[model samples]
Target: MDKCKVDVAIIGAGTAGMGAYRAARAHTENVVMIEGGPFGTTCARVGCMPSKLLIAAAEAAHDMKHAELFGVYPGDVRIDGKAVMERVRRERDRFVGFVLEAVESFPEKHRLKGHARFLDAHRLQVAENCEVEAGRIIIATGSRPNIPQMLKAAGDRLIVNDDVFSFDDLPDSVAVFGPGVIGLELGQALSRLGVRVRMFGASGGLGAIRDEKIRDYALQVFNEEFPLDPAASVSSVERTEEGVAVTFEDGDRGTVTETFEYLLAATGRRPNVDDLDLQNSDLELDDRGLPLFDRYTLQCGSSHIFMTGDANNDLPLLHEAADEGRIAGENAGRYPEVRAGSRRAPLAIVFTDPQIAVVGMNIQQAHDHCGGCFEVGEVSFEGQGRSRVLGKNKGLLRVYGERGSGLFLGAEMFGPAAEHLAHLLAWSVQNRMTVPDMLGMPYYHPVIEEGLRSALRDLNRRLLMGPESVERCLDCGPGA
Candidate 1:
């Protein structure tokens, strides 16, 4: 057997693994990245980029259909599903090429193409022939879409994100399982692109928004685009001549049966650690079969071993995975004594129409952390100037802050320009900004940001500082 030694051996070449590679390279060149195949990161290959492409196409089709609302008349608008999917694949391949080029650019000896299995804590065997002995190891093997066992028998009729974007043609109708981020985004986009879509979730909420009001608003907006059954609980899935038949209980509405040409399962994802031979290591695993690692240092039980990205099951987003990878890489290079890094405030978004963003703690989290001491301020877009002008004057925005101190805790919103607004709120929350600090910032007139400003002002009014605090600040001299 061929044997080699390296400072670090990183498994998987996705975002997390590449991130670790770059960071580790800064400290040591004795780092090798091993992969089985499919070189591109999840975002570039399937997750973010491809989904956005489909959403963009759907948005264009939706805009054309609504052109008459703006006093524009265009007749006989047609949508070519084949062309749309072709563009998605063409652009997706271009993105994937960048990653492949980067990986290929590395020294031939530094890149290994094979599956790696841990033979011991400090050693790994790749594809039975090659052996690698590393002082430290970083596991960045990402994740794969989780398809329930009950639906596995349906075979190709049940699809996941990995294969959904690469379809040669769009299905005539689909039953979307789970109304989380993937389901809502794709289900709505597919419906807008002229497909019959029915979305069903076991829970009442949509996406990860914990604010009940915002969730309700999201359901309302999503229902307008496609049928949503949030209370659905699947009982059985059976293959049918046409496609598949699903029987689910629709809380209060009783058991219902639906047939679709295809079923898209967006329930969740499982970490790609099952085949990593983790049992050979000294690290302890949780009930989910994920290694118990420090969230700050990304270090597994052993100081020389670390787990990052979706494999850790901490934060599965691409950006979060990258951050975790950096932490793991840096600490793994440091060895002996791991260094802890600060994690950013939680930020997540659902790219549905009018969008939905959850920043930091939501309503329930704030209540759980601070009890009744937190104050909530809300602004409805029903009469917002910019939203009315854009004919999207719906949804709501709510901000939570400490009642007495006026410190911003978190925010949840389902409204226009929510993606941008969420970023703004996330930054502020990460910095622990106060209501007064946010209110003092400039807000342009007749814009969606004004809605956020209004919510902050409402929150400020509820705080003990009130308007007097602003007056006091203004009364003081420039340098006071």
Candidate 2:
């Protein structure tokens, strides 16, 4: 029954919403953020933080298994799943506290604990029956795990990533139903902790990643090292008294069933758009429930309404979401197209063993956009001086660039510290850095990163002789 007013109203105080609030504060007199859940964002609560904590726990377990190689023979190796969950909870709580404290630091901004649904184009209704009329709205509702409908037949038998971390006990085995980012990361983590992991997917497992070599590296790491089976596909899942029974159509299309204590439906994530009732605001939705927006400014439906992050689906990277939220907030508060357009597209990395990162366009993608004229070069870390020193022998760096222009278009890496290396390549692509220019840049020796420098040298060589004369093009070569 209470009525409130603000200049700007932000829905969902997650990463994108928090970013919008901070950016809008500089331009608006009154900025308020409305959240449905607790103060912490998913990334801080059950998403990034807790998952990484679990991965850290798994890494410890794995290290003990390899202790013999380090000349320290622990009589036997074992993992306490309960203890790992406790650590995950502790770390998650700490991170949540930090986020709650950080959100409180913005004094002029109001934080309300309630979901906000649009009452009209300019009005929003919150929990406790409160209404806030605002000049503009920024929607950053984020996303939820999308378990496939067919697999939902087993009630309470399926668990998503969010609730998986809260389990009091570890499953004896798990059948991961998708090969997306979460599936691979969690599968590898759980597998390392001694869980029998069977990973299944429809096609191009890990569809988000553009580089085939990087995907192969991920598949190899999980299947070979952690003992995960990548080619399994589930035909049905049924709840059993002891656990869950998953029937799969094997790679040869033979029927097989396996029982696991838990099943994680890590297929993908859908945008949180259904609850908003967009008809109240005249917003249009794509077939997949994403908001239709101006790609450049992120303005949706009308000038006063904006969408950011996973809600729009350009690229779901956290940094990209935060940047989009800032842009949306800034543009909504003031004039449209005030700042220079984002010249660079976002890049993504899988946090699995031998992390994979892809920036800009790969050779095939670039060729499709232009012509098949880009020069591709690759260098491996196996024989590189630095990789051998670090005890990581397997890794490769691939670069794609225009022929005569020598402008870098894309770069991908698979190996130790590849996540960090990919960002540099992303920056170079955005800046149009040339092979000769980037190659001359100082690189410290005996570091995994020097692999990038090695790739640059190979690229420079190919650029000098032209694409036709090139041989041993690692990017196009077998196994990269």
Candidate 3:
């Protein structure tokens, strides 16, 4: 095959790969992006974008079922799973079409539609018998659902988040085998869609939030809202006449079996590193199968090659992936003398019902390091007017700061528009804003924006009264 030369060759056309392509093109003219499978990503086809649409449909169905609570009784609500699935497919198709069109229009950017394998340190072989040798390369292959091997006995009955919504009909019951973001979101979404879902995880938690108290409250709310069995762990899965029989080791010497129409193996996700045949290249791999890169520079052993997105073993959210790709591409194109000056830290958002957003250190983290100077505050969603009006009033906003100095170290929230709130917190943490600086920002009234102000008030009070002061107040307090 004839060797094709380029300034940059990015493997994987997902969010990170596309981001690198866009960012690299701004600096250099010769860029090529190779993607295996379809041109679009799970985010466009089935991941975040499509799954959220399905969840919204389920929410609508759930609301209709309990419409009598609002005094406007709208009769019995019936959901046609077929219609719902059709709508979901339509939405996914529409978004996928946009991505396909975008990629097709980039005539200057060579988009190869096949698997990419490393032929050498700087050369890659594409399935189309084409070879690409670039000055710099970026691997942003992203990740896939990490289903547990224990569920493999059920074979066809088992599905992961990547293909969960592709079922011809809604399952009568489902057993989700994890407590991470994907598991929790799918379990909740399916439960809302009228499936009897029982979720199980290694940790007795709802998601990966740092605060144990908040985790407990989240699990409690999830259990109350849906059928959750945090204690259950699947020993094996066997097919039954109805569906799949999931056997769980209940205790030291006992096992319990439950039959479900489907088994969603929502364990977790791992980077898409193995498929790339990195052995042919000089890239190093961490124990978790992620690309080993400098924590700050995101550069592989050779600065000419970089890894971004989930492949980098850092933050795996879409926003963080984009940022990493931008940084990697910019640095790759910049003169070596100037590349060392850039600074960046990642922030992430897990898009569950009550979205989990995080930036910088938690209060405990700050306390462990800068003990006496730490001031923290928590405000509940029950006090937010927008939350009450939206009827999603079950979350809290927490902030950590330095005493008297007011410098914000971190913030977290599990509530409506949490991702949006994370942006504000990220800005504050990145700039090392003081408590007064954050509180001074005038938030609009009667909107979700008030949650930030309410949270800031709690931090202000905590700072005024000192760390030993009671964290909670009633009646006149912001939390109240």
Candidate 4:
């Protein structure tokens, strides 16, 4: 068997693996990246980019339908499934092309093709032909869509988020399981695009929201558009020539049997570590069977093996994966002198209408992280002036802060412009800015941001810190 040695070796050339390769090259020239699958990232190929394309199409259709609320009537809206899928696939391929260009630019000598599994702490077997021995190894194989075995009963009728973008034409109806990020975003988008959708979640959760108030508000809004059962009582699933048959209780409608052209399983994702034979790596595994590692340093135990990105399963967002990959690579390049790398504040956004954002600590984590010395302040956008003016007045925003320190810790919001709002909150939390400090920032009147200021003012009052909100936003603010 052919064998090779390198200062550093990285497995899987997805977003995180690629980031690790670039970072490691800064410290050592003897680096190699092994990838068994396609070069494009999950985001470019299946996760973010393609999904957003579909959502964009849905948004256009939805806006035209709702324009009457503004006293401007648009005629009957008809969806072109073929054209929508074509654009989604075309644009998706374009984004994937960009990533491919980046990968192909690397010298051939630095790239290895084949799946790799651990032979030992310092060695790897690649596709049965070659073996790699390295001073340090970084695992960034990423993850795949996870489906429960029961869902497999749908057989050929079952699909996942990765399969959604590949449809040549939209299905007539779909039964979506899991109301998490993938299910909620795609389910809502599909519904808006004229597909009959029924979403069922075994867990009583919606999007990434943990706060009951925000989650319930989103749940109500979504159900108004499509049928959603956050806590479903599903009894059986079977497949037939037509599609999949699902039997479940539909609340007021009681038990109902529905047949859908497709059943989408968006339950969650599992790491790619299973095939790597981690048992041979001599690294301690966590309860999830992933290698135990330092969250800050990305080192697995005290060994030369390091894991990051979805492989570590800490936070699977694309940006988090990239950050962890760079940190792991930097530590691997330096070995014994490993140092912890800086990480950005936690932030998650779900792109459903009214959006959903969770920044820094969520409601579930506030007490644990803030020592139970936190308070919450909120505002309902139903009466917010900008929202009413835009005819998008609905949803809520809840901000959390420390009692005495009055620091802006985190927030969970389901409201208009939540994606933008979350970014500002994330920046503030990373800076450790207190609520009083945030209240001093500028607020342009008649904008959606005034809603944020109102919430901060309420938070300041509750905290008994920070100056009273500058008497502002009357002209174009809530109740204006």
Q: Which candidate number maximizes lDDT?
A: 4
Clash count, one per candidate: 0, 0, 4, 1
Q: Which stretches of candidate 2 lie over 4 Å from their true place?
A: 226-232, 251-253, 335-345, 465-480
> After best superposition, candidate 1 residue 147: deviation in angstroms?
1.3
lDDT (C-alpha, whole model) for all candidates: 0.86, 0.76, 0.76, 0.91
Residue 343, candidate 3: how far off, in angstroms? 6.7
Task: Superpose all Cα atoms of candidate 1 onto the true structure and report the RMSD in Å to 1 decimal.
Answer: 4.1
- CA shift of 78, model 2, Å: 2.2
Q: For residue 323, what is the lDDT in candidate 1?
A: 92
Per-residue CA lDDT of model 1 for 234-267, tens digit only, reads: 7888888878888887667798887899889998
lDDT of 2 by residue, 1-480 (tens): 988888888888888888888888889868888889787887888788888998888878877787766577887887888988888998899999998888888773388778888888889989858999988889998888887787786668788998878877677888787877788788888988888888777765563566677667656755675434545556678888867888877657588888887788888888887888777987777776666887567788555888888777676767877888888888777744445336355587877766767788865687886688777788776776656554666766788877787777887777778778888888787777877677656666446666776677677677674442223325423322
Query: Model 3, stretches more than 4 Å misplaced?
Result: 249-255, 335-347, 367-373, 383-386, 448-451, 465-480
**lDDT score, candidate 4, position 284:** 91
The TM-score obtained by model 1 is: 0.95
Please provide, for model 4 over 356-436, each residue's C-alpha lDDT reduced to its tens digit, 9 standing for 90 to 100.
Answer: 999999987987877788999898999998888888888799999989888888999999999899999999999999988
Comparing 1 with 3 on TM-score, the higher-scoring candidate is 1
Runs with alpha carbons beyond 4 Å of true place in candidate 4: 466-469, 476-480
Among all windows of 10 consecutive residues in model 1, the one with the lowest summed lDDT is 471-480
- Pairs that collide in candidate 2 are none
